[model samples]
Target: MIIELIVCFFATVSFGIIFSVPRNSLLLGGGIGSLAWAIYRLLPEYGVTSIFATSIASITAAMLAHFLARKYRIPATAFTIPGIIPLVPGSKAYYTMLAFVEGDYIGGLELGIVTMLQAGAIAAGIVFALAVFSFGKGIGHRYEGGR
Candidate 1:
């Protein structure tokens, strides 16, 4: 429980930094939501590993936020901050930046590759989300056509 809370807190803070959240409220709220999702994996049936599960969970939360923002008629970028809180890839990006700062060209190149991988992970998450969402849409359309 404690570990989860810490992860949530860190996730929120990371979200704030990533999305340029103006104050702590967005951070705290996003963190709490992300934490709730992380805790859900504690259930036996979820069969969740931290990497894949959290990626899916994070993207789900982000999509929910996207829907809400659309419903409320707000800028989608608003969701970018809190929505991306759980999966910001901060540590990897930071190390990549540090490598460049330290003048370690080879190390920087390696870190750059890791940074790209992290980006790919994020892109993969978005692609997976889109695929799931599209699959549901396809099923719905087929069912409606049958009617």
Candidate 2:
């Protein structure tokens, strides 16, 4: 588990470096990635399914991304994209495609569906997080005019 967290940090930092993310934000991005990954890994031990775990982690990533962006004045995506790198279901997608190539149509179909659902879950989680953050930010404020 410790190794996994370490790997998550390095992986995110590497991603930040590769993408030319601003130098000052790399450490925080790596931290968000590690924290998101930690939540994803720990929830499974408590009986949560992978899809749900992924969603929760994604939500966490987005929340941190927002905070990081606000605090540092960097675009939230600088953190969000790197933060979710470790959460991508690359293996499942690869296996799904491999199943298709190997002439296992039924297996491929099942794997493909699951892969899509997982991907959708990640998107949904991010969207939900954005909505929650937006709502929170808008509290005690009113839109007065439509222009």
Candidate 3:
């Protein structure tokens, strides 16, 4: 578990550098990625499916991105893009392509579908988080208008 978190942190930080995220924000981005990956890794022990786990992790990461963005006055993408890297289904996508290359149409099809579903889950999670944040922002605005 400790090893996993360490690896995730470095992986996210590397991605943040590659994406040109601000130097001051790299640690926060790495922390977010590690937290999301921790939740993802622990959920499977409790019988949570990969798709649902990925969705949950993405939501958590997105929410953190919003919080960090507001606090640091930077765009949320600085944190989000790198934060979600640890949860990406890279191995599954790789296997899907490998299956196709090996002429296993049925296996490739199955893996492709699963990969698509996982990607959709990640998108749904981000959308859900954004919706919640927007709703809260709207309410805050309404209250401030009365002042």
Candidate 4:
């Protein structure tokens, strides 16, 4: 448990470095918590299905971060990208590139399709969350101009 927490902390710091997140600790802590939540879902009885779950969980965390940023007057992109990095389908992208480099055209094509699907899945999850949040915020609400 202690090791896992430490790993998550360092992973979060690495993400902060890679993404150029500001040194403020709250964003760093949020990244750690979000990543840890995804990794926690990556275990248990679900096995490989956990990857999909982690992707969805990261999207959810990104959405929550977006909301908090909006409510607290911070930059939205600052929270969204780092929060989602843990679940990015980077391995699949690398495999796709490797297949292409090895002259396995068919395998490369298949991997390309899989890579696009994974990207689409991640995008769909984020869009779904944003749509729901927007609907909840404005569905029946009146504007200051008087609806």
TM-score of each: 0.50, 0.89, 0.90, 0.68
How many collisions between residues are there in candidate 4? Answer: 0
Off by over 4 Å in 3: 136-147
Residue 129 local lDDT, model 1: 51
> In model 2, what is the error at residue 85, expressed in angstroms?
0.6
- List candidate 2 segments past 4 Å from native: 136-147
Model 1, which residues run further than 4 Å from truth?
1-33, 36-81, 136-147
lDDT of each: 0.59, 0.89, 0.91, 0.64
Q: What lDDT does model 1 reach?
A: 0.59
**CA shift of 29, model 4, Å:** 5.9
lDDT of 2 by residue, 1-147 (tens): 999999889999999899998898899999989998999899999999988999999989998898879888888888888888888889999999999999999999999988888888789877887787677676667677883
Model 2 C-alpha lDDT versus the unseen true structure:
0.89
Alpha carbon lDDT at 49, candidate 2: 92
Model 3 C-alpha lDDT per residue in residues 1-147, reported as the tens digit of each score: 999899999999999999999999999999999999998898989999988898999999999998889899998889888889998889999999999999999999999998998888888878887887777656545555546
Candidate 1 vs. true structure, TM-score: 0.50
* Model 1 worst lDDT window (10 residues): 35-44
Listing every candidate in turn, what is its Cα RMSD in Å to the true structure after a full C-alpha superposition?
A: 6.9, 2.3, 3.5, 3.9
The candidates, ranked best first by TM-score, are 3, 2, 4, 1
Q: Best lDDT goes to which candidate?
A: 3
Model 2 reaches what TM-score against the true structure?
Answer: 0.89
